[model samples]
Target: MNADHADDSLLICRTLGGCPDATRARATGLDADGMDFAVAVAGIEVPVRIPFARRISERAEIRQEVVRMYEQACDALGVPPRSAERNSRSRPGLK
Candidate 1:
């Protein structure tokens, strides 16, 4: 992901861990291969599968790359981490 998307991406992942408010998603790494991650809630394991890269690019330069990736996963699952969707889709302006 580019620098501009870094913030959104990171926000997405961090928010996904709100289900039990204990476990957090962790990223292993990324490269030409697919994504690698783990779900540990309250220090326990949660079933999860991370999506790998589809294209070639340099690794994330930011320090929060892993968190961003996790948030992306949460978004895919339609669950924003720490999410409330205040001005979300159902909001008047969204439609």
Candidate 2:
């Protein structure tokens, strides 16, 4: 994959990794506009697509946009953010 695609993939993975109920969710697609995720619900796997509030023009904005989407999803599901542990553990020198 190209550099931009790889970076976007990582951002998507990190974002979804922070979602508590996304164990069964898989990213299906991504673009400058938004991303698509396949999530399991009610014994069925459905696509959950989230578009950014505005077009993202730079790679630096991907993380923020992804985080925003994650927070929005968590709010909609009435769950707390799940990335705290993951983020801490992924750090270079944190315990």
Model 1 residue 7 CA deviation (Å) reads 11
Expressed as tens digits, the lDDT of each residue in 1-95 for candidate 2 is 23333333333333443433333555677789987766554456667666787788998887788768656654554445556446542422111
Task: State candidate 2's TM-score.
Answer: 0.51
Report lDDT (CA) for all predictions. Answer: 0.44, 0.54
lDDT string for model 1 (1-95, tens) is 43343333333334433333423444445555444445455666654433443443556533344455554655566665534665654421111
**What TM-score, to 2 decimals, does candidate 1 have?**
0.34
User: After TM-score superposition, what is the CA distance of residue 11 in candidate 2 from its true location, in Å?
Assistant: 16
Model 1 alpha-carbon drift over 4 Å, by segment: 1-22, 60-95
Which candidate's TM-score is highest?
Answer: 2
Lowest-scoring 10 consecutive residues by lDDT in candidate 2? 86-95
